[model samples]
Every structure is written in C-alpha cells, then in structure tokens.
Target: MFDMFKNNPISSIACVLPPALVNAFAKQNFYSPEQVRHVFTNELKTEHNIEYALAMFCSQLDFDALQLAVTYKELRANVAKECFGGWPRFNFDSLLDYSRQSAGAGGGFAGDGGCGDGACGGGGE
Candidate 1:
C-alpha cells in the first residue's frame, strides 16, 4: 500500500501518515492524489465537518487524535510543497485546529497520548 503512494504527489505526506488514516482515505474513495487533495482543500468546508472527520478517523482507526493532529502539523509544509506547489492554500488548518480542540477536550487521541513520539517533526505551527 505504501509503495502505491510513492508515485503520487502525496508521497511525502502519505509516507508519514498513520496507515489507518491512509486506509481511511482510501476507503472513502480517495485513491488518487487529486481526490485526496480535494478532500484537504475543499470537501471539508466547515469547523463542524473538520471536527466530525477528525473524530470519525480516530474512532474508525482507534488512532490517537493528538498524534494525528501532530502528524498533520508536521506534514503541512510537505503537503503544501509536494502537493500544492508551495501553496498552503487549503482548509487543512481548520482540520488541525479542530483536532487540537478535540484532543484537548478528550485529554488525548483515542489510542495513544500525544505528540511526544517524535514521529512528528517541526513543519509549521
């Protein structure tokens, strides 16, 4: 599955994402880079949607929300550079913000605790 993403625009982003998140996206019919980009850039149009999707992903994958949030933050620049040509023009921030809020409220992501794993590196705020 990882090998399949290597040939696309989201290669860098996909490489670092939790396998569950990648699989969740795949299950949602987001197989192509363009479709995935559309989800990041367009499909999630509101704070509610962002929060809902975050919660859904966490629930579905039993993944740590905080870890996912940290991963998202860590991959922001790569997503922008590799997929959007240095353009950070997307609603991904809303998703990040909502994820942070959800994590804070729930005390953590579903499975793990937080971003201390070091899997997430500095990318953007």
Candidate 2:
C-alpha cells in the first residue's frame, strides 16, 4: 500500500500536507473512511491548515483543488479498507494520542518499527 501510495499521482498532495498529518493517517488505525474523513476535515478546518495549504500549494503548481480533493477522498477510502480492514469504529482521538506517544518514544512511523501493527507495511492492523 505504501508503494502504491508513493507511486500514485495524487500522493504528491502529501508533500503539501504536514508530515505529521500524513504520518498519522498512514500510521494510525482508522476503521472507516467516514471516521478518517471526519478527522481529516476537522484537522484541515483551522485557518491556513490543510485546505489552505493545499490551495496555496496547488495554485502555485496549477493543480486543481476540487480534483485533488476527490482523489484524496478515494485515497482515504482505500487506506481505511486496505490498512484497517474496515473494522469496527475506533476512536480517532485515541489514534492521535497513540501517534503522539509513539513519536515521542522515538518509535517514528509505523513502517519504521513503530508500535503500529505493520499496517503501513501493507497488512491490516
């Protein structure tokens, strides 16, 4: 999955987003697209946040925000299904907390020997 994401054209948007946000999404366990979308949209709601960052970056690169958003939505859905197995609802806040704790402990991201269940390595948690 990480390889697919890396090779995907839409994955370039990850460069515009904060590394922490990208890492959190990729490393953490999100049971459903709706759950991840809720957290993602909320994370972008702040001024000069994800949406603003994407818009500014995309504008300079002549990328389309609407199309990128659509593609990003698809990416999130795929991540939820492939990495999380579309399991039962999980707490988004808890996932964020776990991410923080893991990072603080020098665990890095999931693929880097973090506490995650190897989801980012292309297997479900």
Candidate 3:
C-alpha cells in the first residue's frame, strides 16, 4: 500500500493515519493538513508524540496486501463472542454492543451470517 502512495506524499501520510483520526478529520470537515494535524496534536497533547492515536491505530494491518487495518480489539472480542463461543469468561456484552454499532455505522454485518459473496461465511467450512 505504501508502494501505491510512493508517488503521492499526501496519500502516503494519509494512509499512515489511523482510521479513527481520519474519521475525526472527516467528522469535523477539516480541509487542511495543518488543521488535521492541529486537532491530532491538541487532542493527544504532544509536540511529536509517536503514541498518537493513529499510530496505535495502524499497528494491526488486516492483510499484508491491504492498507486497511483493524485496530479495534473490541471487534475481535465481538467476533469471538458471536461465533467462537462467547469469549470464555470475559465481559463482552459492551464490547459486542460497540462492535455492532461500529460495524453498523461502517455499513453491513460481519461474521458467518451469509451477508454476501463468500465474506462472513467462515472460509468454506
């Protein structure tokens, strides 16, 4: 994915930003890189903190071939709850709710519910 943005510096940095940060900018209708940077800086409160939310956000790349990453660990808990037998002894009720809301807001369902194509069908099992 970085290779795809090698020629486009803005896109390269854009790809590096977490989806949450990207959503924050979009939600505020931020139109400039400086504005986005400002919000990120202030919300996080740091001069050059590598621990910015986006930095933590991009740590989990879903697929090696894709730039999209799933940084929401709650989503994983939800998956484990709904399909893999309810998260053992953990309290996933709220996690399930947030995951559902997030998935809904992001559009469509997840997991083996026969939503579409081969997706969420559990890998031909």
Please give the range of 10 consecutive residues that has the lowest summed lDDT in model 3: 114-123
> Candidate 1 residues 46-101, lDDT tens each?
22223223332233233243454444443444444533345554344323432343
Stretches of candidate 2 off by over 4 Å are: 1-66, 87-125
Q: Which clashing pairs does model 3 show?
A: none
Ranking by TM-score: 2, 1, 3
Per-residue lDDT for 14 in model 1?
25
Put down candidate 2 lDDT per residue, 1-125, tens digits, no spaces.
33422342222222212334445555432223333344445543432223323332222223342455444434344433332334223234433443444335523333222323322222222
Model 2's number of clashes is 0
* Error in Å for residue 75 of model 3: 21
Candidate 3 on 20-108: residue-level lDDT in tens? 34455553222243444555454434434222222222222422223334423544444344433444232223223333443344213
Q: Clash pairs of candidate 1?
A: 65-109
Query: Residue 114 CA error for candidate 3 (Å)?
Result: 26
Per-residue lDDT of 33 in model 2:
36
